[model samples]
Target: MRIALIGQPNCGKSTLFNQVAGYKAETGNFTGTTVTFTESSVRVGGETIEVVDLPGTYTLAGTNPAEREASRYLLSEDVDLIINVLDASHVAQGLELTIELLAMKAPVIVAMNMMDEAARIGIKIDGPALQEKLGVPVMPLVASRGRGVKPLFLAALRMGKKKNPDTSNYLKIKENDRMARHRLAGELEREFVKRGDRRVSKRDRLDDFLLHPFWGYIGLIVILYTFFQIVYGLGVLIETPLLAFLETITSQAATYLGEGKLFTEIVIGALQGVIAGLGIVLPYLVPFLLGLGLLEDIGYMSRVAFLMDALMHRIGLHGKAIVPFILGYGCNVPAVMSTRTLDDPKERFVAAALATLVPCAAILSVVFGLVAFYLGPLIALILYLLNIFIIALVGRVLTAMIPEDTPGLILEIPPYRIPTPRTVVQKAWFRIKEFLVEAWPLLIAGSAILALANYFHAADFFNTLFRPITWTLGLPSATGVPLIFGIFRKELSLVMLGQALGSMSFDTVFTSVQMITFTVFVMFYIPCLATLGALRRELGTKDMFSITGLTVVIAMITALLARGVAMIFF
Candidate 1:
């Protein structure tokens, strides 16, 4: 039996799915669309059953891609039974969707998740009463702590055994109108849910500080500052020894290869790429991805989106646009694809453009591995700040060109939960695996290709082609080739940089001003080829090229200005 898990965003649907699916879940898109869902198989009663977790949707209104995807998958009749995961603390909102699902003519088992949070708010839900009212089994679940997981799935298994379980008998008022269905949801909530004196919980007090108008932004800064500090500290601790080890090996390999042959250069160049990948994954990318996972699992990311909303408006977009920006930190491909969730085309375009500037993990590897390690975190932090300022400025310009009414933010503020180590590690690995699988082999080949190009003296041709950019930005003429390779994968730029410069160590080669300039250029240059494909898929080819052009111009200007500014300090 195939059971589909459905819920609104932050309803603990994903947490519940992960509780059962563990680390082996497979995430894939529907056959022809960018909309993704996760699926896994679980064993229950000695029978293996397939379980699919659909994208989160507020309703079956079909207003957005996620909602539409949810609508399509649920209506397809492919599912054996539906597991409607609901946030027990906020049942009324979830019930609105539930009412829509009941009319869909499928068997459903309501998994009332976050029971602990509901209790903290003094919410008393009569589970059997709700089940009786809806004519579906209602299982209380605290998925985060592994409570009620077995019973929930067992109940789902029992419900799934029936060939065609009827869900329509209880609520015969299957009103098709949206507002009327909403009213029915409220009525059901009123009947089944009770509230007593709300306990003064620590969560409430914590929110008071975290969501405080004055101190909230301060807290965000401190949180991010310390967060990066930890990532940098951990990264450097690992990087120093690893780089020394790799460098020692590279030196030995160079000696063994006897310096001047073409074959030797190619072998050493490939090794640099391999070393760069390892250096990046172990030192910077792993820690960064892990920290990002921890924050997301802890539910702090929602607060970040909320906090960034007001600032988002200044750029002529709403808080929702921040989702793409947050996703951009992991990879620009998904970030670009995620722009489909924004309501306005102009907003989507603007969000997609700005997301490309958010610096993916590859760029983070460059920033932390190179700049943060060589210059200092202070300089690196300044670069991040400047990148933000640049994004806001660019956003204002883009939105002004294609004017539209900015939508107000309508975001859910989920209760903070302690992150689970298993989920956190899984999420981190899920992202890291993308880099390892998709980008590493390319890094190796590209490095060897660059070595061959240099050996044959053809590197000069490519360097000359981009010399205008390097020259105008006050960088070494040699930086041209790496910048070009960067279009394939941002990490390749660093990999190729070692080949182009004929050394792995950057400090001995570039001045502080040169380091700042080169890094700044990489920061804003063309999105990697993968990101370009995503932009093309989402925004079309013309706009993809336009955004690509915009990035190169931004890079040249930003890098030039950075070079001048660095002259004052260093």
Candidate 2:
């Protein structure tokens, strides 16, 4: 039997899935983690049942890809039961989605989740009363704590065995009739909800400082700065040892090659490429993924989205754009995919395009190497700030150019909690495993291809071919090679850059202005292969080409502009 878990953002659907499936899935307080549907299996009464957890969405009627996906799957996919998880404290908001699900005439068992949070907030729910009114079974649950989950599952199993319930009364009403629905909802609330004395809310204290218009922005800056600081510190601590180890292996391989041309090509070209690129990247990726997983599992990311919503709206993006930007710090493919939550096409396009401008893991790795080795921490911070400035600038410009009616941001801010170690490790392992499976093969293949290019001098040929454009941007001719390779994979840019420069320390070879120009060109150059694929899927070929063409032109112009300004000032 197949069961689907559906709910609005932050309603504990993912948590419920994890409990029932007896495995870990990425559950975040934010809307983005569950953007993609995930499937798992559980044994009930000796029968294996498959459960699919769809992305948390607001309303099925919206254009948001996540919402659309949820709606489509629920409507079309044949399933034994629908587990509609709702937030007990925010039933009024969550009921909107439940109503839509009920309209589908499917058998649904409502799991009123987060009952503990509701009780803590002095909001009580009479589940049986609610069930009677909605004409569906309702089970109150604290999914995270594993309370009331078994009963919820039992109810789902019972409902699944029955025929689809009558739901004609649950059809979406016209806008004019919404007032009547609201009145009905209010009546239900009064009958089923009990109020209790309030204790001091933990969130209010944190939000007072973190969500203040002025201090919130300041806090965000500090948090981001600290994040980079941690990345640098962790990268340095681990990378030095790893690099030494890889160098030892490379030296041993060279000895085995024994100076023969073919052996040297394999050792210095193919082997060196993998070791240098993957080795350097792993240290940074490990720490970064771990930090991000912790932040996500602990529910801190939603607070970030909540705090940034006001500023994000100013840029014609919704608050949820924060996820893509944050994910962009890891990689742009997932960042672009996360835009499924934004309901407007124009907003999605702008968010996806601007998200590409957010420096990903490869860029962050480069920054760690360059800043720590040559420019120091202060300059590193400046480069990071430069990235944010460029993203915001692009967002503002695109906002003005696009039509005036951008989608307003309405996000659920999940409460903060300590992340479980098991949950954190599981989430991190999932990401790292995904990276290894999906990205490592590409990395390895790209490395081998680059090795062949270098062996036959194809890279040099391309470098020569693009020299004029390189000169126009005030970058060295050799940079053209890496920029071209950047389209295949972004990390390859850093690899080729390191190879062309023959050292991570480039201050001796290029002036600071030249270094900054090179970095800027690299930063804004073509999107990586994975991201390009996503763009093709999301925007289609014509629009993808337009975006790709536009990015390349903008990168070139921006590089030249930076160079010209540097020449005049310095």
Candidate 3:
């Protein structure tokens, strides 16, 4: 049997999905469009059931891309059962979506997630009464704690086995009537929900300082600074020992192949890239992703979007664009895919365009490994700030050219809660493993290819081709090689840089000014090939090429500007 999990945003649907599915779900496209859903398999009743976590939507009739795609999927009737998750603490608002889902005439088991929060707020929900009224099984769960999730799935499995499951009479009578559904939802809320006196809670207390206009911005800076320290500090602590161990092993192997044969050189080159990825990049990425995951699970990310919405509008984007922009810091692939949530196509295009320029973990690894390792952390921070400025400027220009109506930011600020350590670790590890599985093969192959090109004098051809541009930016001809390799993977460019210079110490090959300039260029240049594919899917062929070309121009100008300023200082 096939199962679909649907809910309104911030209703804990994703939390429940992750708890049930583990880290096994893959992002699947919806009808070959840019929109996507998470899919996995769950074993129930001695049979494997395919489950999909549909994109969250407040209504089936909404025109947003997520809603449209979800509506299309529901109409196809491919799903055997739907598990409609609701925020138990706010069932009145959540039941509106649940009512709409019930109208589909499919078997649905309501998962009233976050019962703990509901209880804390003194909201007493009679689960049995809700089940009796809805005419379907209603299960309460605190999904974040793994409480009641198994029972919820068991209930879904049982419902799936039935030939024809009955829905609420309210759904049956008002399947096509929006007003009637709303009225029915309100009636159900009054019938099942018993509210207590309003009281301030821990989340409410934190929000007082976190959402304050003046203090909130200061808190954001402090949080970001602390985040940077954790990622970089932990990465350095781990990278030092790991790189030492790997260098010893690889150096011994290199000594064995000291004859300088072409095959020997290729083998060493590939090892170097592998070492760089494992030793240099993964060390930083794991901690960075862990920190990012913690912020997401703690609900701070939404607050960031709320805080940045004003700034986003000034650049022709809105608060919604911040979701993709922030996700871009982890990986641009999902970030671009996430643009599907934005209702405006013009805004989606602009957000997608700027998201490519946001320095992802891969690019950050390169920045830290090269710039911070040789120059200082301050320079790395400067490069990051510069990237943001470039994104804003580019977004402003794009907004003027393709003007469109942008809706005000309408977002949910989910209550902050302490994330389970196990979930955070698992989520971080999953992302790291994904990076290794997808990028390693390409990195290893690219290393061997670049090594062969150097051995065969192909570097000279690329050098001559890129000389005018590289020279204008005050970069060496040899720098052209890594810039080209960066298209495959941003961090690979740094690995290739080590191979090109024939040393791990970058200071010997370039001055401080050149290092700064090169880092700036790498930061703003083309999105990695994976991100390019995502952008192509989201923006189509013409826009993909347009974005790619535009970033290249921006990179060149920025790099030259950095070099000019650096020369004056150094």
Candidate 4:
């Protein structure tokens, strides 16, 4: 039997899924985590049943791809039962979705999730009365803490047993009953929702200050600054050991090869490629993923999104775009996928294009390596600010170009909670696993291709071919090779840079101004192969090539201008 879980965004659908499935699916306060359907099996009544968790949606009428996907799934997919998770604190909004779901005539068991939070907010739910009114079972649950979950699961099992059930009887409402339904719902809410006796404390005051518009911006900036600081410090702390470990492996491999031409090439080349790629990636990627996972599990990401909504609105995107932008910091592929949350196609396209401007894990890893080895943390922070500036500028341009109306913010801001260690580790592990599964093959293939190119001197050949442009941009001929490889993989640029400039310190090989110019050029260059592939699939080949051509031109112009200024100043 198949039981499908569905709900509006941030309504604890994922949390409930995790509870019943006995698996850890990362639950974030933000919308759109489950872009694709995730399935697991759970044992209930001594029988195994498959449970599917669909992406969160605001309503059946939503135009966003994720929402449309969920709505389509409900209409087309054959399921034994539907478990509709709702936020107890926001029943009015949650019930709107329930009403729509009922219209589909599917057998639904309502789970009013986050009951603990609702009670704290002086809101309550009369499960029995609500069940009687809707003619469907209502179960109150706190999925995060494992509260009232058993009953919810049992109810789902019971509901699933009754196939081809008469849902019409459950949803029998008069055509002119809008006013009566509203009044009934309001009366039930008034009777059941009891005010809590607990008074607001100092921590609540602190929360108020932090959540205020003016102070919230300050807090966001501070949080972002601290995040970078942690990333930098952790990078430095881990780099020396990582380098040592790679060097030991490389030395061992060098000895094993014993200078045979073919063996030496394969072994040393592979070692150099791995060290150049993995060594740089592991340090920053590990910490960054863990930090992000912790923040997400603890619900702080919603606050960040809420704070950034005002700025996002200026770009004709909703506040939820912040989640994708943040995910872009980890990888642009998922970030592009996350753009499915934006209801407007124009907004989705613009968001996907501009999201590419946000540096991903590979770029951040390279930045950390460059900063620690050459530019220092302060300059790294400055580059981060510059990145944000570029993203905002690009967003503004895209918004003006596309000019589509986007929906206003209607997101639920989940209260902050301490992330359990088990939850955090589970989420981090899942993310790391995902990264490895999706990116590792690409990294390995890219490394081998780059090694072959260097072995056959194809890279050198390209450098010579692009000599005129390289000279014009004030970059050494060797820089062209890395720039070309960067189009395939951004991290490859760093690896190639390190290999090409072997034994030469960045400070000695290039002036500080030139290094800065190179970094800026790399930052603005064409999106990597994976991103380009996604673009092609999403926006068509013509649009993909157009964007690629535009990015290349912009990169060249920016590099030239930067180099000109650098030459004049330094």
Candidate 5:
């Protein structure tokens, strides 16, 4: 039997699915369409069943892609049973969707999630009473804590076992009966819900500060600054000792190998790649991802979108663009993939292009390792601010050129709560793991290839080929190989630069102007191959190429401009 999980956005549907299915899930494409749903298998009552977590939709009538996907799946008769996860705190609003789901001619078990939050707001739902009224099983759950999840799915499996189960007995309302259904939902809510004395809810109390126009922006800036300080400071504390240990091992290996042999170069390259991947990148990446995951788990991310709405509109996009923009800082691949959440094609395209330009953690490692260490954190922070300006400028141009009647932000501002440690750690680990898996092999391979080229006296061939652009940016022709390798993985450029120059102390080989120019070039250059693939998947090949061509031009132009300014000034 096939089971479907459906719910409104921010309704804990995903949390419930993850708890029931663990980490074993895949994105399944819809029949003959690009739309995708999460597919997983779960064992209930010693029988394995196919379970699909459908996209979150408030109603079957919604015209959005996610809603359309859910609506189409329900109409396809593919699902034998449905677990309609609902927010217990907002039952009256949630019941509207429940009423529509009931008319779908499938057996449904309502999983009333977030019961603890609801009770805190003085709501007491009589589950059995709701079950009787709806003619379907109602299970109370707190999905975050895994409370009642197993029993909930077990109840769903029992409901699925019945032959041609009837759900049409519910109110018999048409799907288009929006107002009537809402009124009916309110009546049902009154019947099943008992309200105690109203008290100031935590969400409301927190929103007073987080949602304030003046203080909210202040809070956001301060949070971001603190995030950077924590990540950078922790990176300093960890990277020094860690790199020192790795450097010692590499020095011993160098001593053993006794220099200029071809095989020796390969061994050194391999060791340096391993050192750069584990020793340099992991320190910042772990803390940065953990912090991002914490913010997302606590629901501050949505508030960020809400706060940025006005500024986003100025760029001809909505607040929703903030998600991919911020996510791009961690890694551009997922950031580009996340553009699928935007409803408009133009918005998605524009957002994806802009997101690709954001300096990800890989690039952050470069800035922290090379620029911040050689110059100062203040200058490094200035480069970040300049990058933001560039993104805004590019975004504004894209918005103007591809003008559309884009809708404003209609995001759900979920309640602020303490982040679950398990969820945060899992999320952070997943992102960090992606970095290690994708970048390490490429790093090792690229490092060996470059090392071999140097050993074979062919390194100067690439230098001559890229000399025109390299000279224009006031960087040595030798920096060309690292810039090219950056397309494989951004951080690889920094690691390879050390190998290419035979020194990790960048200050010895590069002037301040050349260092800044190279950083700018890397910052705006073509995205890594993984990000390119994600772009092809999210946007099409045509847009991907366009983004690639555009960034190449942007990076070159920006680098030349930086070089010129540096020559004119200091």
Candidate 6:
């Protein structure tokens, strides 16, 4: 049997999905669209079932890709039952989608998620009354804390087994248009939910400080600074000992195998790539993702969007663009995919382009591994600030050239919840698994390929091809191949640089100026292979080429400026 999970954005549908699916779900696109959904096989009530978590949509008939995707999948004959997740605090809006889903005549059950948030504001929901009104089971749940999870799935399981479900009364109400559903939703809310003595909660008061005009920006800076320190500190603790441990093994093996032989070089080179992913990339990446997950789970991310909305306007973007930027820090593929959420095509293009400039976690590994690991955290932080300044300038220029009149940001600010360790770890692992599965293999293969090129004396060709560019930047010509390969995987560039320079300890071969300039260039250059595919699907082939060219120009200009500045100081 199959169950489909559906809800509007910020309605806790995804949280509920994660509660049950955990890290076992696989994310992919539907058969014909670029729109993505998650699915996992789970056993409930002694029966294994497939649960599909569709993209968040406000209405079935909406024009956006996600909305259309949701509508198509829900209407398909394959869905046995529909689990409509509703945000308990936002009763009316949740019912808007619920009424429409019921119209399809699928076996439907309502999962009222985030019930604690509803109660904290003194809002009372009669679940039994709602179930009576909708003519379907309504399950109360707190997904983050795992409350009522088993009962909810068990209810869904039992309902799935019934050939004739109890949803006939809901099917009687005609849900023809958006306005009709909207009205019906409001009517249902009036009958079922009671608003009592409202309390001003601590989260509401905390937002006063977090969303303040002046103090908010200061807090953003401090929070970001502290985040970097925690990740870097954790990375150092692991990376130092891990790299030291690998160095001993690889060195002893090199002497045993005889350093210059082809077989020996291939084995050591491939192992070094594995070493880089384990010792270099993962040290910073694991903690970075974990910290990022905590920020997102606790809901400070929305406050950031609210605070930055004004400043974003100056750059011809809105606070909503911050969504892609935040995700970009984790990986650019999802960041590019997120641009689809915007209504305006021009805004999507502009946001997608600028998001590429936001260094991804792989490029982040390059930053911390090289800059923070060697130069110190202060300079690394400065480099990040400089990258942001460059992105804002590029946004302003792109918006000026496009010259579109776009709408202001209309976004929901989800109430803050105390994060659970289990939820946070699941979120982090979900993201980090992509690195281990996709990029780690490429890192190993690319390292071995570069080793073969070196053993065969073919590295000179790539270096010569990139000679003019490297000569212009006053960097060694041999640095060219790594930069070219960065278009494949950004972290590969860092690893290959270690190979080209004959040391994973970068400071041994390059001066402070060389390292800073090389990193700046890598930070802003072409998007990786996966991100390029996402951009093509989102903005078309022409814009992909345009954005790729734009990044190259931005990279060259920024690197030269950094090179000049570093030379004077160093």
Q: Candidate 6 on 1-570: residue-level lDDT in tens? A: 999999988777777787778467887777766577888898887789999999989889888778988899888758889999888888999998888888785788899988987887788998898888888889999887789889999988888888877666773465478888888889888999997665677876887788777887899989877887887788768877898899899989899999899999999888877886686356776787778778877888777878889988988988877878876875676678667767788999999999999997688889998999999999999999999999999999999999978878888887887777776776667556555665566667767776787789887898899898888888988798888877765766788899777899888888899999999999999998667767887888899999999999999999999999999999
TM-score for candidate 4, please give it: 0.83
Using lDDT as the measure, name the better of candidate 4 and candidate 6. 6
Q: Which has the greatest TM-score?
A: 5
Worst 10 residues of 5 by lDDT: 167-176
Model 5 TM-score, all chains together: 0.85
| Root-mean-square deviation per candidate | 4.1, 4.7, 3.8, 4.4, 3.8, 4.1
TM-score of 1: 0.85
The runs of at least 3 residues in candidate 6 whose Cα sits more than 4 Å from the true structure, single-residue gaps closed, are 32-34, 164-166, 248-259, 323-349, 358-386, 403-405, 474-523, 527-545, 559-570
Pick out the ten consecutive residues of candidate 3 with the lowest summed lDDT: 167-176
The C-alpha stretches of model 2 lying farther than 4 A from their native spots are: 22-35, 60-63, 133-135, 162-180, 197-200, 240-282, 296-299, 313-315, 364-387, 418-440, 474-476, 486-513, 530-544, 568-570
- Taking the tens digit of each residue's C-alpha lDDT, what string does model 1 give over 316-408? 788778767766775676677668777677888999999998887779878887799999999999999999999999999998898767667
Local distance difference test, each candidate: 0.83, 0.72, 0.80, 0.72, 0.83, 0.83
The clash tally of candidate 2 reads 0
Residue 20 deviation, candidate 6, in Å? 2.8
Clashing pairs in 4: none
lDDT of 3 by residue, 1-570 (tens): 889989998887877777767566676677667677878898766778888888888888877878888878877957889888899888887887787777776887888889988898889998898887777778888988899987777777887878876554534552456787778778888999998788787877888899899999999989987887777788768877998899888778878988467987799778866885685346666777778789988989889989988999888988767878766776676677668777888888889999988998778878888788888898888888888888899999999998777767887888887787766776676556545665556667766776677678787688788788888988878877778877765756787788767787888888999889888888888887767766776788899999999889998899899999999988
Tens digit per residue, CA lDDT, model 4, 1-570: 888899987777877776666554432212333356767788887888888888888777776667877888888878778888988877866776676677675688888988988887677677887788787888888888989888877878887888677886575445424454555556656665554556785447767877787897898788877886797688768877988888888777777778545656665765665564465456665676678778777777777877888888776677878867876776675566556656666877778877777888678766776654686887778777877776777778878877756658766666676665555655555555555545454555666676667667787788898788778777778888888888766865677787676734677777777676778778777887667755665566787787777666766776677667657856
Candidate 3 ranges beyond 4 A from true positions: 25-27, 43-48, 164-170, 245-281, 323-343, 359-387, 421-441, 474-478, 485-519, 528-542, 562-570
The true-versus-predicted C-alpha distance at residue 113 of model 3, in Å, is: 2.4
Error of 4 at 378 (Å): 7.3
Candidate 1 Cα misplacement greater than 4 A, ranges: 243-275, 320-345, 358-386, 437-445, 471-479, 486-519, 528-544, 560-570
